[model samples]
Target: MKILTAVCVMALLVIASAAWADAPKRVKFTWSGGEAVAELNGSPSAESLWAMLPVTVDFKDFNGVERIAYTEKELSAEGAPESCTPDAGTLALYAPWGNLSVFYKPFRESRGLVPLGRFVEGADKVSTLGEAVRIERME
Candidate 1:
């Protein structure tokens, strides 16, 4: 019985883990400066947040005027975050003159339903809410 239980558990983990491995990665790109901390939290639980997913699209060069096709890649338990909490990744469709800025922050006190595809995930490249995790965003 114990062996059967162990096998089942291991099987479940294998199944769950494999599903996430195929998912699109949350690409984070951080540069050297920012003066504020941002978030996405509308609720109070610590479980509801993503901190500082980064991007590199030279927002300063645009003089802060641009538009973008933003998106959110919804994830699941199979894609259990490194924090073991569920979360989603954001993708901004922008270039220097066309794309505005990028910002990934924790879910904070006043977050709203902010759109996903046709809407805005509100990733402001101005918030440095969390410590930077080293990563390479392949263009």
Candidate 2:
């Protein structure tokens, strides 16, 4: 009886982990230059951003490395990591300033930056985006 119970618990755990692994939501970003798809992780900040999707914002080149834009409001950062080392194609939020940042170049670890997602396509095109950009969920 104990062995059967243990097996059932392990099976449940495996199923739960699988569900969590597939929880990330995919979103698309489109601008005059091009478009890209990002896979957002399962964090409160990411969820907040996802909920506010279908949003249009203006983006600007920043520090010769990333494209930065301000969301309509700050996202929930309750469960976000303290810091992150962003690489090319990383999508993140600057918690303090409530701005979204898409990195086209590798960057050192920084604090108060919540990782939202990573671009799965056309990451290079981010650098060429014009001022107006649209973000929306992909089905």
Expressed as tens digits, the lDDT of each residue in 1-139 for candidate 2 is 9999999999999999898668768999998888999999878898899999889999888888888899887788897889999999999998988889999998889898889989998887878766779899986
- Which portions of model 2 show Cα errors greater than 4 Å? 1-23
TM-score of each: 0.32, 0.82
* Model 1 TM-score on a 0 to 1 scale: 0.32
Query: After superposing candidate 1, which stretches have Cα over 4 Å from the reference?
Result: 22-24, 35-60, 66-122, 126-139
lDDT of 1: 0.31
Clashing pairs in 2: none
* Top candidate (TM-score): 2
Q: How many clashes in each candidate?
A: 13, 0
Kindly list the per-residue Cα lDDT of model 1 for residues 7-83, writing each as its tens digit. 99999999989986543333333446533222322222211113223432333322223222221322121222222
Against the reference, the lDDT scores of all candidates come to 0.31, 0.88
